[model samples]
Target: MSRKNRHEEHEEHADESWLLPYSDLMTLLLALFIVLYAASSVNISKLEELSKAFDNAFSSGISILDKSALIEAEDEQNKSQKQRHEEIGIRTQQEKLMAQEQEDLEKLKKELDQYIDKNGLVTQLETQLNQSQLMITIRDNALFASGSADVKPTAQKLAVAIGLMLQKYPDYEVLVSGHTDDHPISTSEFANNWELSSQRALNFMEVLLQNQAFDPKKFSFIGYGEYRPVDTNDTEAGRAKNRRVEVSILRKYTDSSATNTVLSAISDEANSAPSTTTSN
Candidate 1:
């Protein structure tokens, strides 16, 4: 009787067998999730090695994660090839545009040359075509009065004619630049060569812009005064040559080596050509 009472008094032990396997299952789930996250962001070279690890861990020849990695790599390659093709297309289009620009400029130069020759205006105007731009250099006396920035009444027709020609190239940027001889001048009406040159360019540009067909935004003017000169300022004839107005139709695209070659050819032609203006 005493032994039976002692056995009943002994505490009941709880079942602890379920915990070990449950903990192991949670650990495995965490590792799987970690591997999936890494696979998404990893480099292709590293992801291949990780795909092998996934196969080893799952005891399979190829896991779902490995298939995902293959899909990602294929997508990246396709994107790269597409981008390269787009770049090639853009470059080809640019080349075509430049070729057309050159052809148009050449045609315009010939037309202007014909007009100058037919009108007996070769002595007052000249044109040069190069890779950089098509330049029209006009003698100052042809457009402006002595010691004045105002355009002459007779020159209005010339301006209107040039404006008509420029209407075809609405996209080109036209730069009208004024240059002056080194002789100094200061007066109530005019201060110096800078003011004189600037006014000359502005006034002429206004005349060109009066034509509604020409876009005002595509035109600009500047004054170089006596700083930029094509001829020497030491002699009267040279000074007359130096004081001139130039209109340059700028190039949209430029390649330095190609431009240099074209410029050299133009220079050779210019040196061989006869003088367009005589000394005042």
Candidate 2:
């Protein structure tokens, strides 16, 4: 009875021991397959999740595949953070430049206002400073006689003073715009108001350009004729107000058109320069 019992117990235990080694082999294969799959995908989140599952099921720490994925993920995160910070820095710098430009224009406006006040020319001149530009408006009577585009001798001093002040801001672009009353004109010297207005703007700009302190490339002129009127032409006072010239120092941020104008001016100058032949 004892021999039969011992033999049966030994057989049962031998089959059970074989199953333990076979189970260990299957577990090792499964771990190898999981690591290979993780290597192929290379996702940090998925790798961590799978590692946590393996840790719960086994006595091991994180796998090599999971660690590699984690390293890659950290690298990508650092790159993304760096790029975002760079973009923010660039945006902040742009905002700072725009604010500085506004401050400079405001300072110029104050100086012009002080000069106009000291000269007692408030009736004939006015200054306005905004985000887009700093403008000085001069009444027609101060610069020219009736039906004439010629700048008065006294007005030349005013233009010189303005041109000198403009030298302080060498980076800015200046625009001299001429406006006229709604009344039409046709004369031997001028064909129409357009011709008169254009001549007036050109002549005034020529006077300002005489000061070598200012860059010729920075100045441009336009004659609006009677189209861009700020006041009604129905009254004498309003008509007088409309007949004026504006000297504008344009701000760069809100003035894309001004940049195009400046670029166009540069192109024109480049094209107008006389070509010379070079001998080889």
* Candidate 1, 122-169: lDDT as tens digits: 989999988788999998999998888999997878999988888888
lDDT of 2: 0.81
TM-score of each: 0.67, 0.66
Q: Give the poorly placed runs of model 1, Cα more than 4 Å off.
A: 1-70, 255-280
lDDT (10s digit) by residue, model 2, range 1-280: 9999999999887755688889999999999999999878877899899988988656565567777999999999999999999999998998898888888888888898899999999998999986567889999899988889999999999999988888888888888888788786767787666566667888999999998788888888876667668899889998899899988888887666765664464345334421321100
Write down the lDDT of every candidate, Cα atoms only: 0.81, 0.81
Highest-TM-score candidate: 1
Pairs that collide, model 2: none
Reference-based lDDT, residue 143, model 1 = 93
- Alpha-carbon deviation at 51 in model 1, angstroms: 18
| Model 2 spans > 4 angstroms off | 1-77, 254-280
